[model samples]
Target chain A: MKKDVPYFDKVHRWGRIWTLLALVALFSVPLVFSLAHDAWPEPGPFLKGLVAILPLYWVSGIIETFTYTPMIGAGGTYLSFVTGNIANLKLPCAIAALEKADVKGTSDEGEVISTIAIASSAITTTVIIAAGVLLFSIPVQWLTKSPVFAPAFQQIFPAMFGALMASYLRKHWKTAAATVLIGCIVVFFSPSIGIGILIVVTIVAAVLTSFLFYKISTKKSAAK
Target chain B: MDFKSNWLMYLLAAGVIGFVVVESLFFLVKAWKRGKELGISKQTLVNTVTNSAIYSVAPAISILATVFVLANALGNVLPWIRLSVIGNLQYETVAATSILSELGGSLTEEVTDPAKFAAVAWGMTIGCCLPLILVPIFCKKIHKKVGDVVNKSSSASALADVVAAAAFIGIIAAFVSKSINGIEVTKTLTGENVVSSRAGFLSIATLIVSIVVYLLLDTLATKKHLVKFSNFVMPIAMFTGMGAAVLMTQLLPQSLVLWSWPWLPPVQ
Candidate 1:
């Protein structure tokens, strides 16, 4: 027997219309805000920049939406992809199964586990982001009047980025080394090359090094 | 002065927490009803929803905590650097405040003396994090429903499968809206005295466009290559976004610091 299509798919008139309207309304929000605002200064360059960033945000959203489910449901994906799959041999499938609700050993138990996992993740994310936005941004303004405190605090972004990147680098030694080397060599000379160029170039360098390593490893095996 | 004055932020957080509790209860109820219909014990449904809700939020919390640490730290650091760069830069404060206002609600500057700016800062940070807190809760509800369907049938129907996908998209749209609104309000209302409000508008517009272009190129390149390699690009997209955000913050680096500091608390 053929699989039956879902009721939701079968053109529920109200839901379809509402979803469509929501899409349209949401898409128009930024546009409407843009039009209503006064003539922006040197609007050309700035508007260009905002336009440039929109797709990145959009894509980030798309990736984020999917990535969380998988990650929460399955622990091993990160384990295998990040580390060289040492101790976490069974985890990737387990986590994936958990998220996809295809848990092994028992079907009933698996469904319960996966469903709860997704719900809790959603709740947690919403709460933290909202709280973070309010709690952190406020003190930022108060410090502006202070002479000593304000400047001391400003290094957070670079520091955080540095810390995050550092952890990743520590995990993958050669690629990280090569990326830093390339970034520093190029960006040091051309400070104006901007962060985007620095990132793109560094990622390319890392990928190249990975390729070279792969080639070397295969050749060594063949020689053996 | 009173808690009532700050009730909005509290209310927002409370609403989110409430949603999680209520949603979990609703799922449990549905699960029980379904189980009864299928002749399973109500206890099974309760156990299932309770377990599912708890498990789902753990990772979401982890990710949120990571973001909070980064964002709050950034908020703290931005102002100091911005001030150091442009010392006593006469009342760029208005520009900064306007930007904050454009982003969402106006700075409580007028009501709270600029001397108490720190307190106001605290308030805004709490308020801004409300959405981050709320959206994830909804994710769990959707997850539970999906779990139900999957349990009843051997596999999830396409529609059920897509609910998470759809909800995730909605969350993204909400985020973008929040960001854009912030920029426009900051530029239009708060920064009005400095230059044309349009300046902020136009500049943010350009920045957004650039990010989109960069992402498109990055995504297309990923699609053409090894699947694993392509997947790696998602984090790169986030990295690019941070780079873009940092760049924008640089424009009025002080404003970026002021508003963002609370969001990026120190991780360790």
Candidate 2:
């Protein structure tokens, strides 16, 4: 079957429009606040604040854009970037959906499934957070204070990733093993390594290793 | 005007969150229709939606907890709005605290001054907004490059799959390692050594349980030919792992304290 070139092009067009508008809308919050309160941030402290986080977050953001965009596909990329929480929520959800549907990220079916999954996850997260905020008194208190539930909340990342890793490894054991070995070495030896930097390095290493392995195996098969 | 926890601030927050919801709904409808046109069954699409929704709850609640922490520092509405939009728990907390400390104020205290509050709101908004702008500008280019490489031949397409799998596995491994290895030791006032990494241990335990649960469920689903069960397995494994973590915490020794990241919301 031929690719849906026009459909993807349309998605990119609409994605650009929505995200640019989102950028404007997001900045407007602080702008409107300053105007309404008749108060602008002091130049010194504001610059100081920006300088502190700008370097790290900017680099991380740039790295993430390159690393995640291809994996998430066109529609999923657009929506996940806007809604945020890429690593924690949207990425995992999208990957699980793709895996369940048995679709490759490079395929048209993969693109559609990823988009649907990410959109649904974003909507669900927004509604849940909104409800949690609006009904904060009892829910927040219980969530934070209930001793029985505290560990569950604390261990959330591990639990979510564990399930995801199992499924992923079952399909791609060689790549998963190599990645985990590198990850373990970095994490164990230098505990202070930043998570963002760790992710970038591991990805580079995994891709290089996988490509080499694929080349050698293909060469052997051809020789045979 | 009082800037701390004002009704006007809440109204502003509500407006931003409303825009996000509308935008998400627009994309959701578009994607759903596209999937239908592509011959994906309605049941599959609905299952994706349901699965994603269920998968989102635990993480959403975690984000909500961070909102409560930020509410204590920056007031209710700003954190509410910040988190509802492009902000995550770790980045916002770190940004707010860093900005607050720069101004000689702490995030543990409320920001009553409008100027300081604006500084924080702007600092967070701008610092995190880079990706939103960059993604739109460069996502198409990146996608095009990937598509070109993958479309070359069958071998190239398989290589691209390997690359994607590698990236995902590498990222997941980093996270898992961090959870397991993020340990610390501190001395008490009485000079007793306290191994303060119960949280890490709990997470390790959770990871084990989740993996086991997922494998068992996956096997059962395959045997029974239950496609829906496969779709729902992630959330189920997560919940089971979380339940096990809770049990471990209750039964674990007191000397081993469960330490959260410094930026995480404090247990109140």
Candidate 3:
């Protein structure tokens, strides 16, 4: 909402196709090579390794967008709308690139933040892909002795996810605590119910927390 | 049928279990209080959670199940079936990762290629992130609908509103956790150590550094003695903390990042 922030019209005007193309161009680097070097001694192992890591890369991209944005500005406003959108859109890699180039746009802060956000995204993306390969793909390769690929890909999704959740909990400790406590209790008692317990617990916790907040606020008003 | 990999499945199952229970309680409490305050029947709250969870989750679950089934079918029939459904995108991902690992390894590896590695790495750049990107667009609609529901309430709508939002979130969490047990399960298995030890170390280091940084920034923001700038500290701290995860990823090797490994009974 900042006056200096670039209008959404200008930034998003390129459309989703542009976003997709950017993403494709970003991802196609290796595919082109694989095609060119078709006989590169069983692309399976390498390909499998990459697939195993897809989850990590994906999650990191999201996290990087989050990291780079000044989501919490002085008065709870984002520094720049462009940076905010990229962060919200969960597309930090491209955001970072846009920043690096200092793409022409509205607002000095938006440009600055976007640049930082993009750089941050690029760095995190690299880390995510690397970690996925090492943790998921490498071990699988070592064990399977085949390009059959290890379930490392699965690992990537969870690692990024769990880390993200953990961070969220850290941010809103009270909500997280409530969520976890209720979740554990239900699971402990009704072991066979699968996710039903979560539904019950979540409802219970949220209502209770809200009620508590209301009570506190009313009490303060009374005193005033 | 393979037991070795079954550990992963068991891990997933347990996670769904936890995710469901906790999420349920959160929503139930939220809806119950809100409904009561609004003079609506308690059942309405329960129904809201149940209905929302079922509505949003079923499709994604089916899609996942179908994918799994299809994979198995192809794998069984082909035996050596390497379905090139998505082209050779795999090679690019691996090559990119290897190159990144090498690049992050240190400055010594100069002969290494950059463009090839960048391309390969780019394959995974958006992995599970596609959902995050998509979810917001969808969530906006849900938020608006819920806002309308809450706004219809006659009493202290603020409190009722929070409860309603919380209920929606709970329902969504329950449904998503069930549909995507894989994420939670992996976390649980890896979490025992990751949360307690690895995250612990990182958290501590971050806390200390954040305090120092806070103090330094505090001088700048408070130099004029206005509490206005001082409020920036929390956001700054939050931004820094969020960024720190990526920073650690950059600094540590992949193996070192996953330093948590708590022991649990083997899944039968």
True contacts kept of each: 0.04, 0.75, 0.09
- lDDT score for residue B110 of model 3: 26
* Highest-lDDT candidate: 2
Order by TM-score, highest first: 2, 3, 1
Q: What share of the true interface contacts does candidate 3 keep?
A: 0.09
Compose the digit string of candidate 3's lDDT tens values, residues B1-268.
Answer: 4321234323422332233233224323432443354454444333333322322121112212222222221111111111111112222223333433433421122212333332333333334225334432332343334445546765645655446434433433333232222112212211121211112233333443443455566566657774444434433443454345446645767566444323312222
lDDT of 1 by residue, B1-268 (tens): 3321244324433443444334434433432343365454444344433333332232222333333222222232222212211111122233234333433334333322221233223222222222222223333443445456746763244333333322222222222222222211222223342211111232233335434543564457656764333323322433344444345455655654344212222211
**Candidate DockQ scores, in order:** 0.04, 0.65, 0.07
lDDT tens readout by residue for model 3, A1-224: 65563323222222223334433432343344334434222344445545666655454444333322222111011111111222211222222222222231122233333323332322232232223222444442343332221222212212222322333233244654565456545544443233333555565675676567667878999999
Better of 1 and 3 by lDDT: 3
Model 1 regions lying over 4 Å from their true place: A1-25, A28-129, A132-137, A143-153, A157-171, B1-268
RMSD score of candidate 2 (Å): 4.7
Give the TM-score (vs. native) of candidate 3.
0.33
> How displaced is residue B1 in candidate 1, in Å?
21
Give the alpha-carbon lDDT of every model.
Answer: 0.33, 0.80, 0.33
Q: Write one digit per residue (lDDT tens) for candidate 1, span A1-224.
A: 98875322321222233233323332232223223332122334333433433343334333333334332232111111111111111122122223223233123344334333333333333444345444643443344324443222222222222322322332345644555555545533453342323333544565566556556766898999
- Point out the worst 10-residue segment of candidate 3 chain B by lDDT: B76-85
